[model samples]
Target chain A: MNLYGVRAIYKFEMARMRRTIMQSVLAPVITTSLYFVVFGSAIGSRMGAIENISYGAYIIPGLVMLSLLMQSISNASFGIYMPKFSGTIYEVLSAPVSYAEIVLGYVGAAATKSVILGVIILITARFFVDYHVLHPFWMLSFLVLTAVTFSLFGFIIGIWADGFEKLQIVPMMVVTPLVFLGGTFYSIDMLPQVWQTISLFNPVVYLISGFRWAFYGVSDVHVGISVGMTVVFLAACMATVWWIFKTGYRLRS
Target chain B: MQPDISVKHLNKVYGGGFQALKDVNLEIYPGEIFALLGPNGAGKTTLISIICGIVNKTDGEIRAAGHNIVTDYRSAREAIGLVPQELHTDAFERVWDAVSFSRGLFGKPPKPSHIEKVLKDLSLWDKRNNRIMSLSGGMKRRVMIAKALSHEPRILFLDEPTAGVDVELRRDMWEMVRKLRENGTTIILTTHYIEEAEEMADRIGVIREGEIILVEEKNQLMSKLGKKELRLQLQNPLDKVPGELTLEPVELSEDGYELIYTFDAQEQQAGVARLLRTLGELDIEYRDLQTRESSLEEIFVGLVHE
Candidate 1:
């Protein structure tokens, strides 16, 4: 793998981002701000606190996940989809860029957007309410890990999608629903034992819980379990991406 | 001269049992333009796609500059560049960026000078900074060609490069192709425009029904398979062919003003002399006579249908 090839893909990917900064960067910020207002202030004012931390601060992790998930899925999926829709994939397909390079370029770009959006939401949340970070390392680690993991997952979604409708189905129907039901608004412990057990199966619950733990040093889920869940999901997503590249699935055939 | 491409018994069948190509064998020599002539769905694209490694071949072997296209795609692909028929480009990207990125895809380092030369050659120097979407259709097509040539490939494949292009651009592209050939690039072109192949191709291959029907030097193929027609204008019109005239190789014109006779020029016994003698014996007077030679398009259509 030549660095130049990777650089070319990275540059192209960013170029795509620049083309729709309003949607990529600005839209997420606005959406996250709304989340902070609606969920953070409107609901948190009456809900009070969770685990000694204010509800306003408690929901920060879930908010970040919301933005990260959307950004990762949209950025990566559209990044690949636009090329295909415009018939420009042949440019990449015919080029000497290997499958690995293509995946790295796209996923890397998606992660870049996810991180930027995450940081923006984190910073924006401060205006609404000041939150104390219990461990800076854990917070940063979770942010980076979540961004990379979801970006890889998004890359797979992009490959699997054949059209714009297909692209929207996974994120809108599957990912969005999972994130919402995974306890982004409230902890699963508040549910019945059966529902709580079912909620535990949702991969995103651990991501949000792990992130919540980082923000206020407390969560309904154990930190170790959350971290372990994220690692497992990340590994599974990476493996899926690797398999897609190795088999030349939609990229070639 | 050594052949730049050698394809033997190539075959490709898509997942739905669609056989795009079948037993395609061809040898494109270095520094010559070979035109693959065919109608739509005639396997022109499949043949070139297989050679370029964009589509997998179900069976057969293809070597580009002696490198197997499947086993050794990198070097072989590096040796060739393809100008796809579609006008696809990064709409938001600058022309210069697109060209340079294509070059980098081949693992080549950033070379501003090389980029500058490619842009200048395609008359895109002024539009280097402009977004690709802003360019006209002709300009975008040129950019596609520029990108293909950015790597300085030894063999260039133009799949219907002139389709939908205006006359001026078509002429300009032909001139550019000629210059590239002069620079020693082996060019393979597939086109429906017989005039383009007639004017540009050193050798021509007619393909149809997923098979290569004939491959021969342009002039040789034309002469070998060409037919000539003679139309004799009659002083008096007849609605039906005379019994005596029907015995020879002749048909009366629908307008009843002329007799049409077809003959192969390459054949030793064409019966043209005997037909003319018979016409004279019948005292069939004609005002004038005209002869038409088969053009490449006619020969191509004939061979493909045959």
Candidate 2:
């Protein structure tokens, strides 16, 4: 099954993360911490609690989701794209490993990185806001599922993109905007009735909602529906990645 | 004995409909150094890439070590390694780590001893910890070969292994190629240097415009197509040929100071003896006679031009 190949790619990617620790691990953690400083401490002091929870604590799930979705996509996209860019992809393609093993190695490492960062942000949140997970297992599950799903999606994007600018277009243009509008700092309920209805279409909303339910048992959308939506999205991403490899789209010629 | 690598009726037409390789059939014997010689855009790299599984073939079959390249790719690919033409490598990776990564990627268990041996063999042991970018061009080329060898494959494809390197490094690389062949690794290399092929290859294949026009043993090809020329320095100048040379035709120099006779390589002794007898009968006196044999470069150029 070329398990050694999978481990090679996984360990190679993990090594790259360690090499770029300042950008990969530290930068995201610092960004999340600043969100705490500005949005949690300074801003939450003026805003009243919504849904009987402190404003500082309520945003924890949303912030974690923000970093998770962003970091997962970026880490994974860059991880695969760099090989295509540097022409090292030839080695992987020509190796004895199958496409499945390649994906397992790359996406696994990226997802693992995102999960670690997500947890670090949670721990860092303790210094500023006293947050508690209403369901720890569910929280961890959601974190992992979201990271894996997004990493797969990022893998597709990495294969699709031919230019460095194309790599940034989806993450910056589509993902960041969705996360911001997905109720990262405020619930969709706080918006007008029409805006709240429109927010349901944003896929990130379901992820954040499911994650928020795991945190405080309060969410804009039902937990079951949120989980269902995430699973559907995950399936869609898996299919896309499978198709990319099967057709050798942008990979083999 | 069975072939280590067999390619039959292989064809490749890229996305834009430009055919890179025609219906090519080749069989590389186990433990032999086979060199593919071709001009630029002659499908040398494309052919290598297809066999290595980097480029998909449009049609035909390829097998490595009795395993089909596509249907039974794991076994097929596990038996082969490729060093591409370009110097493409992970610049940020240390030499040892990068080579080890290749071994693992090919599904082999980690072997530090094997990695160490490859490093020392390439004379890169001292630079194992240094980043690839820090190495000289020759060392980087060695690193590429090291990576290809990391998996200990039975078949190795070296595409232009000595391109852009200095003469001394080229010699070293050729020596390494010979050493690998001695270890029973079947090697198929694409190269522009015909002399290198003449020096090392057991057989040579000439590709032109996506087609392999000729493939034969190096010595056989030379003997069959080789042209031999003999020149005579006249003791005195003459205006034109005396026309008494009936067995063969001879060309007179413009100044009438020398005579040139071209003959088949296989009839070297007979052809030369007949020419000299005719010259003596014609009373053409010469001070010195010299023979020159056509090199592989000339033969290659002639084939490509034709």
Candidate 3:
């Protein structure tokens, strides 16, 4: 109900992104662009087509997903964590804002930033490869959904972390490795039969697969299953956030 | 008139099983400066935090501006602004944006003129465009005050507003506080400085061991509990109090060179007259006599120790 409060927080967070444009927006965009140059141009030239699509075009969606997942988590986590660390969180908590509004403001802004970064990376990728979006609507939908879900996940990490080191632990140790092993540069279909079966268990595989399907209408898993898994994860993150606010966990004493 | 804030049977037990607040009750009248005096862990911050909706109470009810802080959180919180003890702000943010954003957080529409006035009042108008990190310590504290007043709430809670502040800023802050009171804002401040309470508080409340030991009008508490001391420079040294003066609250100085008489200030006339008459009749000569009224600091120490 407190739309003004939500807008204020959203604007404040977005402004922070502007202030740290090089770190927040430009770094990821440039890094993903380099991935296109290295992986798409250099490595793809030596590989055969994937699912009847050129190798360079094939990795575009995956590259964008890599950046999206990382950016979403890092942005959201750092957004909330900085406030906690600096103690300005008391200002927000003491205001008239509701818990839902606070989440919407922070997570929404984080997702917005990630989604913008994803789109920019996609544009940058276009210069290196000839990719087509078989379903542009679905591509956009998947982009937003992934950003929001991961941002929510990041929000949880931000709250659960008590120190700066803990903040980077999940993104650096768990998420980055998962994204790399989730077929960002290669298809799970190319893996050994047993490894492919095991790759199905890696959650990032579903996201990348579903996102790639939006680009070329082909995926390692059923697109429907990928979307369903994402929705399930989204619901779980929402439930966890609800519990955090209800119990005043970490946010209050 | 109904109190601006009413706390009933409040209790706060931390997750670690440390009881931070006992069954405490207090009512603060509207438009009055009330000072909560206590040491570091006396639960002054806890009580303010619970009322501000920042900390959850283990058991109790608090109503601000007639809204229950728990059930009607938004409304209750809208009526209150808190200047916390910690000096924390968005280091990257400009003063203008920080104060303006705080107002917006309370769901108030942006009013540039009002923000300008608040900035001017706090002597921060010139630094409105400056990043908070670039400001000095006193300037940052003023920025905090500006942010608290941005929403123009009816009630303001200043938790150690003058702690670590320079004397000049402290004086300015006190003057600003009085100006706010004139504007009809109810102010509740917690402080380690008893002189601050003595100077500004219309009513003073002392908290000790998570309980409110006393709350009374500042003048009344001073007069009731405040003792007057009479010091006599004796012509002759004495090892003990004279037997005739034993019934009075009298004691001999450790050096045995002076006689000290302690009495309630309310009975100043009769008590001093009788003491002087007794001294005259006993032939107890004194080269000098001095009378001193007990300060709020002494009274506070006495109550806390008791």
Candidate 4:
């Protein structure tokens, strides 16, 4: 809980982030912009609006979600994996820095990257297609929550992963597919009744839906349910992360 | 005052029932250099890992500066510093950043002058700004020491600190370790080089097959267990030993030109003077003679063989 320990870890992680700014910070900004161009302008211009919103406006939440998901996973996973790979984990474990301090430092760094990217996409979306936030506070709330929750999930992934290839498995195979199928570009309502019901089980559906609700004051799923699911996930992920740190799972083992 | 470090009945059994340590007991006193020597896979690294809290012991009690390593880890860990055998560090981090960051890990307030003194003592001040990956192997080793000493721990464990190092660097490191001890830090070193123990250890412990074969003060261990030899040079090449020489414990050289008689110097009657008289009675011609004293290496080899 000491801020000094947190600051030490934070500075170490940010230094790593700074070392690869092109990969961590800038790459996401550029990738999200491309999504705006191709999906928002080229694709959205031809297709009509969904739920009375423009095609450009419809994909903004999804794009933000995409960046947030990838960056959070990448940041946290790399943060933990690199230390293991480079053998610096020994130094950190031997230090007076507590497990909680280590987690906070890494998760905080991941959140920093994801949140910054989320904000950049939000600002960029304004240029492509003008949109008004029905509830700016809700928008900010979901943005911060999604960033923190996913970062924690990524932190868990980092702890669980043994090799570089394993680091990518969760985010690439699991998180990416969940984000794409969660109705980022299209609505689950457009599908048949059974498929829509099945899509309801994907946890990412709630995150995107909740963010969308924050934007236009309307969403496919109930806003309360989406928010509730996010809260549940945040708790689950934080608990799992804390347990890993407490048990010294892969770290001390 | 309590011992600087202590381990009682320490044991570790790996997953396939491979016992790495069995009923090991050891203590390191304050301001003394204790060397742990053993062949590979003899549990030197495992013992160190458990003491440093890097590896879990199957059953044991370990305390550093009166703090149990398992229950009171923070204080125990804070009381000691470890330099692992591997040269692992954040490759991208600058040398200064790496050392300073390691200090911060101990929750110590930043002190610029103390860090400067550490870097200077290790002769690493010039390379402080260089990235760790760019440093040479010897330089990297110094950085490891710098990082370990940054937190100002009372006890330091150096696991094979001189492996793969040149003689000069090895000597320099030994000197630095002595200086650290002079300043009131207890040092525990594990080395493959027996000479390091011979030259530096106040006490030595030898382990083999996950068991501590022997532990004793260096000079006492040598005198108590060390064997000495008298090498007799023949005045003329002997085709065979005289029948009277059979009564004595001696080894004939392959060429049959010299006789090697080994005996415990600590024994009351070494029989060396009698052997020479017998040689003279047999009219054995001798041109020269020399004495060979057993070294710690020979003692270590002897114990491990046992």
Off by over 4 Å in 4: B268-270
- The list of candidate 1 runs beyond 4 A from truth reads A246-248, B230-261, B267-289
**Residue A162 lDDT (model 2):** 96
- When just chain B is superposed on the true chain B, each candidate scores a TM-score of 0.92, 0.98, 0.97, 0.96
i-RMSD per candidate, Å: 1.6, 0.6, 0.6, 1.5
Instruction: Output DockQ, candidate 4.
Output: 0.67
DockQ for all models, in order? 0.54, 0.93, 0.89, 0.67
DockQ of 3: 0.89
lDDT of 2 at A20: 95
Q: Give candidate 2 misplaced runs (Cα > 4 Å).
A: none
What docking tier does model 1 reach?
A: medium
Model 2 C-alpha lDDT per residue in residues B96-205, reported as the tens digit of each score: 99999999999999999999999998899999999999999889999999999999999999999999989998898889889999999999998888889999999999
The positional error of residue B143 in candidate 3, measured at the CA in angstroms, is 0.9
Q: Residue B102 CA error for candidate 2 (Å)?
A: 0.4
Cα error, candidate 1, residue B165 (Å): 1.3
Computed on alpha carbons, the lDDT of every model, listed in order, comes to: 0.86, 0.93, 0.93, 0.88
Q: Which sequence of candidate numbers ranks them by TM-score, best first?
A: 2, 3, 4, 1
The digit string of per-residue lDDT tens for model 3 on A208-246 reads: 999999999999899999999999999999999999999
Question: Of the candidates shown, which would achieve the greatest TM-score relative to the real structure?
Answer: 2
lDDT of 4 by residue, A2-80 (tens): 5666787888888888899898878887888888899889888999889899988998998899899888888988888
Clashes of each: 0, 0, 0, 2
| Model 2 CA lDDT for position A142 | 97
